[model samples]
Target: MKDNFYLGVDVGSVSTNLVLIDEEKRVVASIYERTRGEPIAAVQRSLILLKEQMDRPFRVSGVGTTGSARTLSGVIVGADVVRNEITSHAVAALDLVPEARTIIEIGGQDSKIIILREGVVVDFAMNTVCAAGTGSFLDHQAQRLGIPIEEFGDIAMKAEKGAQIAGRCTVFAESDMIHKQQVGYPLEEIVYGLCEALVRNYLNNLAKGKDILPPVVFQGGVAANKGIRRAFEEALKCEVIVPDYFNVMGAIGAAILAKEKTKRTGKTNFKGFEAAEMNFSTSSFICQGCSNNCEIVKMKLEGETVAHWGGRCGRWEIGEVERIAKEQVLS
Candidate 1:
């Protein structure tokens, strides 16, 4: 009997993650690669890598895409379901921790907080304007301190007390770190201090007006940092849980969603593994129809337009002919 799997792809600004889940909702294969500003290439490379990692042959019965580039990725992979990062993260968190009341996710470029009550999302907030509370900022600090990002948490764990650092903005944080170094603060103390600062910033920005209940799960690239986890626990006065597969939770959530969607339809739109070999391209143009001037993005496969997105009114989603006709009627 052939093994069946569901494929999920999450292409974000900083990373592209892919996860393959079996019918039992267990992760079979996963890939995490940097997007490096080219999401199409990253997704293709991730797909190829995931295929090579699997020892046995498997059939992908469903495909889902999520993250910042969900629409573009869906067009490339022929996804059965396309969702946003919020929905994908919430689903994955609920799957892992059914009683999870709060989810704190800090990715490479942004951070988000989700509040759930009885398995339903009640409220959510995201901080995209600031990088001080995100993983990329931590990575930059690690590099500045001549420390490997992988060892950051362990080093921070050695500090008995962290130094105070400003967390309102990345610029201020970096300046504070430099000043601390100049003043002869211990490296570990400074590192942990930065972690605490980021936690404070997250709470102040995203978790400010909401009720952050217990069973708080922290999942994202930043969750790998033990220092940040400790900081959050100290601030919230509760234990924070980090799932084993924190980095790829978005992709896992996407896969789970794909499975659910395909089960109802009894079919899939997966383009098969061969999709990795296909040539995909994207182009964008500013719409002149309205004051919003929404930048419309068009995705092309094999030199043919396959999808259109990134508009305030979703006018481009209806295809070129219909969009033109609608505009004419409106005029």
Candidate 2:
């Protein structure tokens, strides 16, 4: 007999993460892969890798999707639950740290702050416009400095005192870094200074006017940087908790949600491993239904329309419903 597992997929702008959890909510397997502007291919590769990692035969009891491409992922995987990034991150935080009051998530392209009280999310903010304090910017700086990003944190830790660097935006920060280097600032100090600057930017922007109480939890791809963690601890004057599965918390949270939903509904919508081999494609067009002119996206599986969304009105989604009903009647 095969064991049962819930699968979660988080397809972000820069990365695609997948997590599998058993009934007990323990992570069975997780994969993190670069999205590279191709979410569909990234998800397919991740799913194939996930199956290879599982040593025992198991059935995916439920599936959930979250992140920027949540709708597309749900359509591809036949997810039972599709949730937003904020909800998924908060749920994962609460599960790991029941007393979590704040969540600081910095991914490749964006950053967000979630404030919770008593296990419920009360307020949250996301920085979608800027790239100064995100993983991609840091990676860019590391490359410019000819340093391995993997060693960025340890090098920062060696700094005795960090030099001041502009934190408002990436351009100013990069120019300031070059100036500091020209003035003979130590490399470690410069690196740590960059970390500190990014943390300050995060606090000043997304965390402004928000009471960031402790037991603050930090997750996302950037959480792997110990230098940034230390910078956050220093700025907040509190210990920041980094979960064991920091990079894939969003997917983990989605899995937990899938488990809860399937348990309550007593069934799942998962398409099974065969979904890996299925042909999936997406297309978009301007609605032109009204002045709104919303760009509507549609996903097709095996040459049949499976899902559509992204209209201000429910026109596209309703069309999907009508199409399904017509198919049912024809069958």
Candidate 3:
């Protein structure tokens, strides 16, 4: 049987997730892969994996993308919907908790807070400058101590103490972790302390000056860590809810956007599952368009530029024939 599907791609700094949602919004097939400094390669690998999972051949009806690298990805896949991380995350949270007021998202490289009222994003904040409270930071410390990252949470759950570690910056936290380790502190104690430190940093940095209330949903890859979840519960002094599809919430949110956009426009821009079989190439160039000097990225098919993006000032977005004409005249 032929099927219509939507493609939702989230190109985060640490991972890339591709999700296929059927007309009914059920996730038919999903692929998750590490970005590992090569987003194109990661997406290609995810496509290959996704290509092998489908029972029937299908085509994309619409495609939406989000995350730190959304524009680059949207162009690569010929996406129909392109939006920011905050919008994408908010959309997903609203779908899960119809009346959710607060969103706490902590991933590998960054964290974000979204406040919603009546399903609309009223305020949002992102923490991209620090690493002390991110998943990768926790992973690195866990590895240094010869402990599995997954076990870090289990140990924290058993912690009898939650000492305050320097949480203002990553460097200070690292030295504090070493000192605690050398002092023969219990692994569980250190783990819980680290969790507490991260949560403290997060609230102070991202949730500052915001009325963070209950009916809160925490989503992101870090949402899987029970220690972080517990830390949030304690810090907020309120119940924090984690959605069922916590890790894939961004992709889920993108898929939901695709579904809604397609419904409204009565059309989709999806390129089918067969797109998985095609050979695609990607490259990047810097645009000297002012001090920003945006690094415009391009996705190629054969030799033609299928997509070009990455200019913060929109100096490199493709498909704008008029803009290109203006460029020619200006030059």
Top candidate, metric TM-score:
2
Model 2: how large is the Cα RMSD against the reference? 4.5
Per-residue lDDT, model 1, residue 97, is 97
lDDT of 2 by residue, 1-331 (tens): 8999999999999999999999888999999999999998898889999999999999988998999998788888888888889999999999999999999999999999999999999999999678887998899889989999999999999998778999888888899999999999999999999999999999998899999999999999999999999999988999999999999999999999889878878999988877888999999999988999899888889999887798888787844434533653775
* Per-residue lDDT of model 1, residues 1-331, tens digit only: 7899999999999999999999998998999999999998999999999999999988999999999888788878888888889989999999989999999999999899999999999999988567778998899999999999999999989999899999888888999999999999999999999999999989998889899999999999999999999999999999999998999999999999999978888999888888899988889999998999999988888999888877878678754334433643775
- Tell me, by lDDT, which candidate is best: 2
TM-scores of all candidate predictions against the true structure: 0.92, 0.94, 0.88
Q: What tens-digit string does per-residue lDDT give for candidate 3 at 214-317? A: 79999888888888889999889989999877877788778888887777778875655455556678788778778887887777876887777667765556
**Lowest lDDT block of 10, candidate 3:** 319-328
Candidate 1: which stretches are off by over 4 Å? Answer: 286-294, 312-315, 319-331
RMSD of 3: 4.8
Give the TM-score (vs. native) of candidate 2: 0.94
Candidate 2: list runs displaced more than 4 Å. 318-331
Task: Looking at model 1, report the run of 10 residues with the lowest lDDT sum.
Answer: 319-328
**Candidate 2 residue-wise lDDT at 327:** 52
Clashes of each: 0, 0, 2
Q: What TM-score does model 3 achieve against the real structure?
A: 0.88
